[model samples]
Target: MSTGTERSPAVVGKLSTLDRFLPVWIGVAMVVGLLLGRTIPGVNDALSAVSVDGISLPIAIGLLVMMYPVLAKVRYDRLDSVTGDKRLLAASLALNWVLGPALMFTLAWLLLPDLPEYRTGLIIVGLARCIAMVVIWNDLACGDREAAAVLVAVNSVFQVVMFSVLGWFYLSVLPGWLGLEQTTIEASPWLIAKSVVIFLGVPLVAGFASRYFGERAKGRQWYEEKFVPGISPWALYGLLFTIVVLFALQGDRITSQPLDVVRIALPLLVYFAVMWGGGYALGAAIGLGYERTTTLAFTAAGNNFELAIAVSIATYGATSGQALAGVVGPLIEVPVLVGLVYVSLALRSRFAATPPKSIVHHD
Candidate 1:
């Protein structure tokens, strides 16, 4: 791994307390959410009372707060150079859109054949490519920040067009061809559009607008150094709040069905390993080098769970097995990917890294 300043010693010491202890906080949030859900008689009912298209309104607001800063942190100005590398672009797209979905389909079926709802939920997870947390993972692994930003922007755009189409192909058509039981759920174009528009699109535009105007008003240095840190803490706060609310609503069901959570978790664990490993191997095989390779692997491994959960709950119900499966995704992904960050660090020495000309990073 590159050292601290040079990407070497790319270890836990480099992370802030929030990022370093993320898994613990997430676990605590889950426990607290469960307690609130079970202890309070009408907590779930009250939380679910104010609904934004089936999801609790509090969760929706928390999501917006959680995402805005993350999106704002991305260096949108770097898109031009990243997109110039057609090889990296093509590899990322194939891994994310084509191979990623196919692999998840195989795993979900082979692993959870008897559970159609969970299988369908997993399939939706695969379809909703990463737009949010992958950047956090890439950063942790000392990956190329600009490349991740561009790739995430690409995935966000692709979701509008491809999520529904792929959802149909994988969940409905492919199953029919193979003579497996098909899921009754139909992926809605509008659902993806609205989620992307609100969750992804709204923050995206706000982030970009803030970057443009902030820099224009006070210069990049002031904005990056002064302004960014002030707002950074809210990201974790929003994430924790959202997690607490989600689990609070579904806590009873999740606590009750331990076996089902394990089953859903197994396929997701396998999916992350295969995707991350496969992505790194491909990047290294194709000579993308360390930084871009790390970015590629993370972008490939991560999925848009927010979109997946929103789609599941809106299409099914708040308490459906599909929604439950959707909730389990990040629960499994957070820690697994954190471990993978160290794996990427250890593996970095194996690759010969050639630094690009004049790459700018502010973190």
Candidate 2:
């Protein structure tokens, strides 16, 4: 964990408050979404109309804002350290792309063969690695923030490039083992690039620029204290609203096919346990400290549901198997990650008696 002895009191105070309330607010937002979904029928469609240049405005803006803190905290110097830790990186990559997908596929086949409606849901959940939420998890776990930041940047870049390729491979080439029919997946590259620009590029650029300017003008203390806290809630609320809209769009299908949730949950739970455990063990075997281990574990375990959700809706329609799978990811992700945070804390003592030195630097 980053020691704050050198940090300005005001910045520390701001972060402390945000760290405390963000999760609670996120939980409440979820419940609110469920209630709204059940009580108000056309609410999602109404909200969906808030779009920019054909993209859903709330989701696009939420995605951009949510990434701000993530990019803001990243340490570019970590790129040098990445090469030094080749073993950890290779292990994470193999597990995330290879074993992770295979295990999810097997679990989905075993759990949901009878329910074809949710088969795509399983694949989407399995293939999408964590993008935004992992930053929060890494922060909470006192993980190597620099490494986590670098990994997230790398993953975000890779996700855009590999989404179509992996989506096709999973849907067509890998479906044979489950006796599933090959489904055609189509996405306009232009639209995807646009989404990536609005959701990821804008926030990333804005965050970097803000951090740079703040450091030069008011200082890092002022930026961290005043600006970050103010934006945090809005970003989180945007994410919650996005989730509500996503689930609301699928409310009718979910209400009708209640069993689909169960079907999607099984593989997801299995995938989470397997990936988290595998990453934890692998990190330990490589003799990494607790912070690095936690970072590696989450980097492997987390899924990028935003891109998955967008692609699912675009390629498979809102009510299709793909979109349902994307929706099921967060329902499983939130609580599971919270539990893992505790687990990480418990394992912290085993790795190092003191906090890792890597996390001590503020910048």
Candidate 3:
């Protein structure tokens, strides 16, 4: 018999109707993008040509719009409270940075040795840890929202520094060790750095500035209640637009061999399941409460596909197999993670009977 912790009403964030039908929206976007790409001649070429030093200018702007609102919600002031639970922090970090990448590398090599571009793409997806969507998932699971927010903030900062170095190493160096001589990406760490700065840096700065100034001027409640909510929807709009643009550019490739998406999705599904299960077990072993356990699990399972897609297109051209793989990441991830939400709810009853911990202390 399994004991369970009671669910707290405060822990759940009521998802909007749009949030509930997110999968349908994304799927429609994919189809519409494909239609535009096929029917409107020169559409893809026009979008692709709007580039600066190999980075697509339009996509960069779209990504910045997509990422900024999420970053703005991060309460940098609350970061100090995270230290009270160092074990959970350490475990979550290990799963995200260390084990996550290694597992991706192993799976990519094992499943896609013959398909190197797809393999590189999968590795890229694994490296870009969750920032935005995990919050929704954490909320739905009744997880520790403050901890999730802190981890998201930390990951955002960490990604800008680490993505380039790791991208170069995993995509350029590690493939050769496995005796895959032909699998080489000429992409430089500088390119990844440049993309991260363009997509992530600008928004990160904007988000911090907005939060810092707005909070001081209008009071915390106004900033939190009004300012944050006002900008949040923009992120989703940007995401949908980015998806359309991605599919518009890659329509030909996708239409030719649609099975390629399925191929890419295989490893991703395994990665999500493994990461969620591992993070949950680790949290349990460390004696974390139900809310914290769900936070760690959802965070571990989620991928920042926005960053992944942008980096893929920037590193390899939009039409490349790698870019298609990146697109597939979100297409599969959204629905899968949605299903995991219910799983988390169901499994809530199986957790040890510890009283749920309140949110961390902060200003």
Candidate 4:
């Protein structure tokens, strides 16, 4: 909603072609992963065998690499002003923690009650929330960059504490209470914590440290223009690599239950559309400025599929229905978010925007 200023085509063109076609890459990753899983003899087993405890070492490495760049982009210094807008911040939190998950829970049950593993995966996707790519979506929508960064930082910290508890309660306990099938899935908070520590916490610390020291040593321009752009693609590569590994591990299952991906996708599609509209209406109703509203809308709508995928693989085997469901999340999300980007752009002129100079600036 925030028309910060009409950015030049040159500025918009700076967004890499790969970023524009993220969904295509995701689809390609799925096919490639399936191919590798089916064709390569012993490859899946070989990767699966390389584990520390229940966590796959290769997948863990992939997740860490995928997460760090996204986390590193957060301007932690900008966070001092996040609390300055308490109403908008409170609404953002409520959307992510309450309405977001509640909607997914109800939809997952209503749509996929017969498929518990896939249901659990959808629930996991909902709880993880967006910490990474929402920044990209927000930026594309001309949202307040600082608000987006601060909200992302807040969500990252909140997710570290809450994801496991919520994942456990919703996936394991809530279902049983509702008389849904008792799933064998172990949504252990510790397991979730360990995954969070490795995937989210490490990257968060590294991102902040990188920003603090790099800015002091080299200056903000060099860090943002040179360093940030350089590391950005690594996140995408890491994601594709992890996806390949996940699907390869689950080749047998994927081959057998091809329609299950479609099944997992249905609820996610609804979540994105409904949550985006809901967040936008809530923001407009609460008298939020366009930039903040755009930030809130994208942040609420985007799912941290990276974290969801990691947790799914950790909690359930890579080949389990849950892991497959997790992969389907990004497959659904990338294109959906891309479409929302256009929607936001089209609606920009209709909404009045406050100057975001006091809030944040874009690179």
Candidate 5:
């Protein structure tokens, strides 16, 4: 008989109430936003009245608030153990950086050929791999927790470097190379770089500084156990506010063209399934066993929807289709990924009955 630890998590018990019903919250936010925008005249215009760097100031503030808490929760000091395992690290890097982005690019273009704004938004989504929530998914699925931590930390750093670069390349150069008439990306590389710096850079530095000082002052235990829980809810509050404002600004278009929301959702659904399945199959083929394989799959599949929304709004304006596409990301992702947690558990039997490789020991 398997030990209790060996058994898959009863997914319901593992997740917090907030995380378990995230889709419901997101749905309510959408409805509330739509109602606010539709029922209240001038709601959209008033929100848009204040602009910072050509984007609505509330959105910029919301993005920073949403991202900083999540980033602060990362254990940046623990990257050393994960680095020793070259095979795991290499596979994660390739799947996250290479396959993940490329697949999303292909899916976005193929599925969204006519809608250039949404297509570019999806590409931005692709470039942003590995979300903070993957930890919850991976843990519920019995994945290697340490590996997931390291990968999240790495991707956090990786995105700061590559988001703008990939945005420029995929939006401009790749389309040129493919001989396809790309949509006019009003934001140049310089503009994208500026957005990335303000949106990602500002929060990143703040997160790092807070953790560094917080831990030093009160020890890692208190910082994580006490300080983190205190601030974690702000991420959700920020996300809700950002969504409310975004949907409010674009609610008229979204309500009129409901088909556009459906279109944006289709590619995201495909991207999540393909990335998760591919990662699992590759993991089994390479003998990472169950835990590491599960970790690989969740990390590979999850996208930084918060960052995607931030960059999209900052670059394309809150009312643009690109922003709408980014808004639709977590809408589709939450329920789909929650379902995948069960799928991962059910399929855990397929891996060989073996203890996962003891590369990095996780608590």
Candidate 6:
């Protein structure tokens, strides 16, 4: 029997409301971004600042603030219970690194060949997975929060290594069967490393350190009650705003090429459906519980656009189709994942009826 404390009504209610309304809020923000982008042509560049340290300080700040609360909830020790669950980890890795990319590549080839601009966009978007938003979605789905946290940490580490190598190889080395030109794709190892450090690594360290010291100085209960909940929604809102500003910056380009939205949306929709279904099946085959299965499914299906966007800009310039495709990813992903969270909750009853598996521990 589980001894974990049930969530408080207030926390549950707030989460529920956020889950219900977040999509609408994001939609509104996206529209607002388009309008703002149209009205303020130079606003995106204006909001962006370059530092002597060779970084975009404003974007980095937005990413840090957006990522902090999500990472703060992660507890790395939770992976011990299933250290030997190589099947689960293997499934996730294959889906994220291998199958996901293949699907994206296939979809881009099939659906976006005539649209070379959108083709590159789809490639960049599909190559990434959600690092921050998945945490919020997992929590809302009543997932094993600890497990979700561990996966976030794992994915973060893996992306720093894989994104540069794979992105370069994908753009430069892959055969022209997919229409990807070497000149169109550019990868900068240094810039990608900087973006990961600024956007993910720094925030993770800061969030963890803050949580650790706060728990010690106050107490675990106080930290969870007073801090976590307070910060969670705000972090989400921050992310939404940052995305809005990004879209606003691209508003004129998007407005000019309206069909690009449909082109970007189609592959993303296909990617989400295929990955979500595959993730759920793999998790079930591994006998993970409902919460774990749902967590893995959504995490697998979602794309980490923050890193994708950063990489796209660094590699292909801010105005490149690849960068635009990265931006379009969240527009589709956020709403779709929110809907899937509810779907997972509805399926919880079916999963709960199965016999429980032994809780295996690993270090």
Note each model's CA RMSD in angstroms.
2.9, 4.2, 5.2, 3.9, 5.1, 4.5
Model 3 lDDT per residue over 1-363, tens place: 011234344332344555556667768887888887888899989998998886667777777777777667767676566657898789888999888888988898788878888988898888888876676567546676567866776676667677766766777677666666434444445655565566556776887899899998999899877887777677667767876886787676667777887788889899889999999899888988677888899989888776677777766876777878887787677668868876887787777664434342211
Q: Model 6, 1-363: lDDT tens per residue?
A: 011223345534644454447668778878998888788657766755454254546555666777777677655445565455576677778888888877887798788878776677677766666676676677666676666666766776777678766665665578455555553555465655565567667877887797789888998788776777777766666667766776776677777876887788888898898999899888887878776787789879988786677767766677888778877787788778878876776676666442333221110
How many clashes in candidate 4? 0
Using TM-score as the measure, name the better of candidate 1 and candidate 6.
1
lDDT score at residue 13, model 6, on the 0-100 scale = 61
Clashing pairs in 1: 2-7, 2-8, 3-7, 3-8
Please provide, for model 1 over 1-363, each residue's C-alpha lDDT reduced to its tens digit, 9 standing for 90 to 100. Answer: 112244443544775778667768878997899899989999999998988775568987877787777667667777677889888999999999999999999999999989988988898898889887676677657687778878887887898898878888887899899998876666677777776677667777888898999999999999888888777777778878988887888788888899999999999999999999999999999988888888899999999887888889878876788889998888788778878987997887788744653143535
lDDT of 5 by residue, 102-206 (tens): 898899989989988899899888887754557656755657656776677677667767776777788888889999766544434554455556666677779
- Give the whole-model CA lDDT for all candidates, comma-separated: 0.81, 0.69, 0.73, 0.76, 0.74, 0.69
Q: Give per-residue lDDT, candidate 2, residue 340.
A: 89
- Candidate 5 positional error at 22, Å: 3.7
Candidate number with greatest lDDT: 1
RMSD in Å for candidate 1, one decimal? 2.9
- Judged by whole-model lDDT over C-alpha atoms, candidate 3 comes out at 0.73
| TM-score of each model, paired residue for residue | 0.89, 0.83, 0.76, 0.79, 0.71, 0.83
Candidate 2: segments with Cα more than 4 A from true spot = 1-24, 177-180, 191-195, 219-256, 353-357, 360-363
Name the better of 4 and 6 by lDDT. 4
lDDT of 5 at 334: 60
Model 4, 318: alpha-carbon shift in Å?
A: 4.9
**Which scores greater on lDDT, model 2 or model 3?**
3
Number of clashing pairs per prediction, in order: 4, 5, 0, 0, 0, 5
